[model samples]
Target: MKQREKKELDTSVQGIIIREMISHVTSEHMIGQKIKNGELRKKLVEPVWNVPDGFLLTEIKMEQFEMEWLEPESCTSDRVLLQLHGGGYVGAMRNAYRNFAVVYSELGHGMPVLSIDYRVAPENPYPAALEDAVCAYRWLLQKGYSGSQILVAGDSAGGGLVMALTMYLRDHHEELPAGLIAMSPWTDLTSSGESYQTNFEKDPLFGKTKDSLIYNREYVGLEDPKNPYISPLFGDFTDFPPMLIQVGSYEMLLSDSVEVAKKAKSQGVKVRLHVYEGMFHVFQMAMKLMPESRQAWKEAGRFISLFKDET
Candidate 1:
């Protein structure tokens, strides 16, 4: 293992205010109330739907799911980013991801982004999201984009999905992408990581809850929580592509990223893990407002650049 560096907590005014705001607004009770009142989607979408200028969005209908392509005004790179969004495996793709897709495209050196609205849980459940991911990857392959020219990126549950997707590809003899980028991945549905207790009170969004956000029955659906396809922390990482994982120190799922990085590294995978102190889960969503978030995205761009030209 490499020597661990001490990281300073983000004590910026914006960081402090944002953390408080998230804790107050999206606390477990507030989220439950929002879901009950049918206002969660709107509330989540309103703040992040503002797509930056100079990007174009095109919607495509798959056989069972929908995907949107976000292209820059003058994209010259052949590489593409397949984006899986995070909403605890239950939330549908919204305009927030459209904005995120813009960031991925611009920061990924002008490559186009394909963001999917994969099927979610309680209705679609376990294998549905995974199956949809496979379909999207196959679509890209059929469209003549080699797996080497693709990168898979996601946040939260979507982050875990990217790993599961890669594992599935490897197991089924399909080609893998050039790399992966996961932000605060929810890799362990078992909720066994020590951070679940250590950072419980510090996690802004999920601190108040006994279990992490995505460790619910809706998605697991009678499947083993440790199933590599579901949890991914239990998955094999042999022959996996280079990966960049970013997680916040204050998140209950912080150990999810940490443990996965350790496992991948042990299995001879190239892994870069960044633990940003004092930030909350998926803080990259605040890239426009927080310095730490911006730095995280810049790191993502640099990671993407490493394989953007690979054949």
Candidate 2:
């Protein structure tokens, strides 16, 4: 095996470490309240959500969940990538997700991407989001796309949902996806990972070890935090499709990805984990300006392409 070089912070990524993601910290209590009251939508839409030069975005309605389609002119209609945007189970699908979806499409040489706008917490919680995700997949299948032609991708909570949704399908003996691409996935909603404490200072998005309690409580409502559906880190990953997991070195949820990767590997799943040094959570949203983010998007597209013909 070739020796992997130690990754340093890309200059572009380093420049925005504080300005783009880190410096923009909000109080945990207020953020949670905003989520509960449904007032954080505008605040969560970052200005960085610009569609790239060659991609086209069209809003489409689904039977259960509405989605925005991001497609490049070169993209094929048969192979589709379904995405779930992250919001800690409360935040809605923001513009940043649309931008990233386009980038993912471009990277895959124009593979169409369906960015699902699933329901959120404090209103429609837990199984609600999961149900919407499953419904979206079912709608896709109903549209004549086989399970092997669809790849599931999500960031943060969406990433956890990617795994949870797949596990749910497996348990129900439903068709599985071609593969999975999870970026900085929040697999452990319980906030029990060691990186939650160790990387707390280095992470810019999540402030402290216990900062996610309110977000967790609001989403998990009346359910065990460690329940496999809520916290996929504890779920059975055996016989899961191939997985591509990317996480930043400075993220508080780094261990969440690491633990999931370990468990999935132990269960004989083909898993690849890439830790971008000095990067923060869900850094792919910076694909427009950050080289590493672009590279991460490329990696995800490549992973998705690997299974386009396994059927």
Model 1 CA deviation exceeding 4 Å by range: 1-10, 27-39, 42-53
Q: For model 1, how big is the CA root-mean-square deviation?
A: 3.7
- lDDT of every predicted structure (CA atoms): 0.86, 0.78
lDDT by residue for model 2 (1-311), tens = 33223344243545355434443444346764453333565356566556677777777786656878778766555778888988888888887777667666765666788888988877887888999899888878987888888888899889999999999999999999988999999888778899877876656666453434223578888888898988999999998999999998878889999999999999999999998877787888777566777788778767866765433
* Model 1: lDDT of residue 255: 90
TM-score of each: 0.91, 0.84
Worst 10 residues of 2 by lDDT: 1-10
Would you give me the overall lDDT of model 1?
Answer: 0.86
Q: Which candidate is the best by lDDT?
A: 1
Error of 1 at 248 (Å): 0.3
Report the C-alpha displacement of residue 183, candidate 1, in angstroms.
Answer: 0.3
Residues 274-297 of candidate 1 have per-residue lDDT tens digits of 998778888988977988888898
Supply the TM-score for candidate 1: 0.91
